[model samples]
Target: MSSGSALIPLDRALARLLDGLGPVAAETAALPDAAGLVAAETLHAPRALPVRPLALRRGIAVASADLVGATPHAPALLPSAPPVVLGGDVLPEGADAVLPADAAATSGPFHEIGQSAYPGEGAVLPGTDLTDGAVIVAAGAPITAEAVLALQLAGIAELTVRRPRIALMGDAAGAEAAWLKARLARAGCAVTDAAPADLVLHLARDPAAVVAGPGLALQPGGDAALLVDGTSRTLVLAPRADALVAALFALVFPVVAVLQGRRLATVARALTRNMASQVGLADLALLRHTPEGWEPLGVGRVTLMAILAADAVAILGPESEGAAAGAPIAAIPLQEPFDPR
Candidate 1:
């Protein structure tokens, strides 16, 4: 008796949809324990590194005044002395610095009656090792073995991070959920709490199972994103799931996405910042394709650019083209490979 609601073409809707997700950052996030995690934070030095002057070799601390006229043939004599170990603190009282224990042979006393020690010829003095406020490491520095050593020497106990949150809702756990969770956590998210997550990942062996699952049945609260994997039964719940998918697509990716374009050398960067301690690349991809269509370009199967524009939708996979009116369409996102650099 009456025709169904006119289908909203994919192209126009998608452009509008992706444009709304807001601007993606120029740089992405990396795992906490990985090398990139330390680079993103404002890491400052705890104090002057080394804390004190360090002797480079095993030497004896001698006062400059005591070494005057001392030579290989006839050395000055003084009192008993101790051998300085490498990295030991150098004293300034009488010893200007440290002389290798084997460098000079001592016959008599350690110090002479009236000797003169030249400046800068002896062991290291206090405050000469390192100065305060000297930058041991700069901010946004990538964590390296050297950097770790520097931090440890500086006495830095902990670090701060911006980790992202990820949740998976699948029919059952085997490998897919594990794989998906790994990926999400890498994208600057903290894979911590699952109940009522910041991002709700819905996976089903069958499409209908998505709606029947507790994830869809319960009205999710908070600002959470849903990633749905298309299944055979997925098409069965087409009416409801499709609308939800459409709405979510719009929310995630709005129309006319624009970054500040430049004429030349306008290299764009996209980085995800997280506070969590653990992250992995399995959860985060630079590109992807969902059942809703190409991610960040939500054009569905029948997308349209303009009235005169040719149809840009292409069915590349084994699946056939076009579903019957009221036919369920699966929602799988086209994924882009993620590079963790």
Candidate 2:
């Protein structure tokens, strides 16, 4: 169902959705649960990693000066003062280097070294991995698995992050709504119908219908329109569930990022099929991953079959023309793979 209204550019539509919007309030989340959420504040390392100097190998700790003349033929005998150490053990006092077990022969309490030992060799010094007060995660940065690992290594148990409360109101029984709800939930947003929503998305079939309050209204059929103020902002999309879901993801992802106080990341992949431009209107075409590469499904041919066979969606901007086959284009992959076969 195409709306008679002129199509708004994709970038312009997103800008409208982001107008007057701010980041959601920060809340404390456990480190494990903080993945995918935006950091509300800068996280600093409370203490240095490793905590102290650690041996890197199983060997004898000794003064580097004693091993200056060590060679394969004339191996230097280490003083029977310091004790042997294993990997990850703390170096003994007054020992500045470690002679690896392979390079040293143990005889009673003394060890024979065949190689020169350099100070700080075969050992990790304190603060080498992470220093105290260093920024682990900057504000507005996404908490990734690597970030989580770093935080855990730095002994961080919890973190403050922006968890936006998004309200999903529409055809609750419809597959599109359910899919959108799950996607939003996976994006770290709290999806509910309770009052005081940071943003509301009303999914309707009618393009002219108005919804209460100021929010976005998505109409799946034809050309999409994003209206502001008390007026309804309806997005006309294809009737097929796959088409509708692709359209919803393309429109809502940026809005969620704006609300979370983070910039949306753009990812592009090679397109397997040709995609024609819509001139003024922005188009999101579903894609399927084949052995050849990513194949874009035609917009007019979008159906449950096409959706089921697709794994991603390629977005064509308003300013650009159609893309030829095998051209790299921006795309978003479906969270779960769809197998049409």
Candidate 3:
């Protein structure tokens, strides 16, 4: 209310936030700690996943050629079978197969191979688990649980990834600020207190103060602003407790996309009722996904009740006039992915 700057479009505001910003420098992280981050570049296996043949069962390793023609009727007697290897153990140098406990019998200090064995019987041949030259993780892929599993299986302990570091500039102890911190982390940001962070989120609610930043055109959050200095971008969020969340998706989330090179997930849902929006300003619609479709809770400065009742949000861009009943819209999901509802 104090700044006389003209209100800027939401997209323009986001673009200003990204004016000179780029993905932060890549850092090496242990595989276990890399989850929820984006890979800096495509990664290939450093070596074969399992460098040697692997025993798939608890049994004696054997040279398959030596067991040909051997059977219960005419067992091939041997001084000893190849060295014993358990599940997950590497087959010994002289062994090409794993003879199950039932396949071998001991007779007068001699190990008898009673069943024939093939070269790869009961064993995973070398490079079969994951080839030596296969791609371990593609560029820009999220370091998810599955991706981490494959990396670990490939004997990789670390990865190079891009994790934007953000500095919180406002009421870090306030409930709204804490919520913002958590959501930012889920978007693959490292929230911290000091300098060197790639971005800063300044939370303020001082109505008497005149600040210099972008003229935010978002309803319920138009008072917020964006401050740019050198390579540092600070997002000033004047979040009334009820407007905290709506303001974030409206102003802050898009910057994450610019840095990480990926978009946050959204689910398509049909609106349950008509939702009208101003043609000139961006609108934030809080919603509850019901059995039939999305039930609009409230738009603009929604109530605490509206926030609690909501499970997702739909942002009507600056160019839009909102949607009619049964109109499908892309919404940012606020609940866990496994919600039964």
Candidate 4:
């Protein structure tokens, strides 16, 4: 592929790369394997939660009318047939309320109710937790742990989600591939070698040697080129492993948004220090934590060891000139020990 060395704005480059890419197709997956995947369609509760009224405490299920006139001193005796119920148990067929065990006295077969009972007291009614046909998760939403549990509790055995397939074709021996694989795995993408991948990334020594495709090319000198030729897309970056990895933070979310049908903007954690932008180009600077605060490492000094030593990265927008000390900027944390203060 012919390569042109033009310094395109980061935002414009990302928009071009993500313009036509979208969730591949819907597929079924079990609840446990659904975490981090994007929902392909809105998931609705098939049935109301707690089909029957559920007891909320350890008590005797009794009709509320039976304890209407009951008092502490002059207690009302409950019928011997009232079933003993524990917390989270379904209320018995004939019971409309629960009389707490501690609030009643038992003698032989009869249980005395010392307090008044109210209908629906100490019980969760049908659909209280989730209503039938209500949306459990909206389309394009990420499936989180909480969402998984909710789906399981709602009796959903399987869900349809979009698992984007990404292929890594270069720099196998470098940290960039490893880091990208790990990051995509954490984001619930399936990295595979299957033909016609949703996205392909190539690392090259010479910008002119990049694979022929419709994609964006990023170089170490802050130059970017966008090539569009139908569905064939690729991203070419300079083989400086550490700086390439740092610059990737600005691109990952946009890629995810395209593959998951999400409307998310490229965002990073808030920066812990001020950052200076290049005169005409956006800047992606690696940051390390020190006893004083967070500081930006020199762009030329970003090596694999230096990247491993850093805890975050600060991204200066194209519009801004520089950030004052303590000014909040967007940052991408590379490891733990990231403190915003």
Report per-prediction Cα RMSD to one decimal: 15.2, 6.1, 4.6, 5.7
Q: Candidate 4 on 1-341: residue-level lDDT in tens?
A: 22322456667777877777777788899978898777888888899997888898888787787888889888888657468899899998757677767776777888777788888898877778788898878887778788888899988988998777776666645766677677776665787644367776555655445644322322233432245457766666555665466445666556765677765432234345666655445556777766555677644235666677777765556566666666554555664211211
Candidate 3 or 4, higher TM-score?
3
Question: 1-341, model 2: which lDDT tens digit per residue?
Answer: 23313544456666767677777779999978898777889999999877867788888787787888889888788656456799889887667667655777777877677778787887877788898899888887778788899999888999999888876555556766777677787676888864357666655665345433322222223433345563223343323464456456667676677667766554567777777765544556777777767787665345777767877766665455678888887666665221111
Q: Return the clash pairs for model 4, or none.
A: none
Q: Model 2: runs farther than 4 Å from truth? A: 1-3, 6-16, 46-48, 57-59, 62-65, 81-86, 96-110, 119-121, 131-134, 169-178, 201-240, 267-274, 277-281, 287-295, 300-314, 317-341
Ten residues in a row with the worst lDDT in model 2? 211-220
lDDT tens digits, residues 119-185, model 1?
Answer: 4444445445445555543433334556566556566655544332334444426553454445344
Best of the two (1, 2) by lDDT: 2
Top-scoring candidate (lDDT): 3
Worst 10 residues of 3 by lDDT: 332-341
Compose the digit string of candidate 3's lDDT tens values, residues 31-119. Answer: 78998777887878777767788899999898888889998989888887457789989888867899877777779989887789998
Candidate 1 vs candidate 4: which has greater lDDT? 4
| Alpha-carbon local distance difference test for all models | 0.35, 0.67, 0.76, 0.66
In the predicted model 2, the residue pairs found to clash are 1-221, 1-222, 2-222, 219-235, 220-237, 221-237
- TM-score for each prediction? 0.42, 0.70, 0.79, 0.74
Per-residue lDDT of 103 in model 1: 50
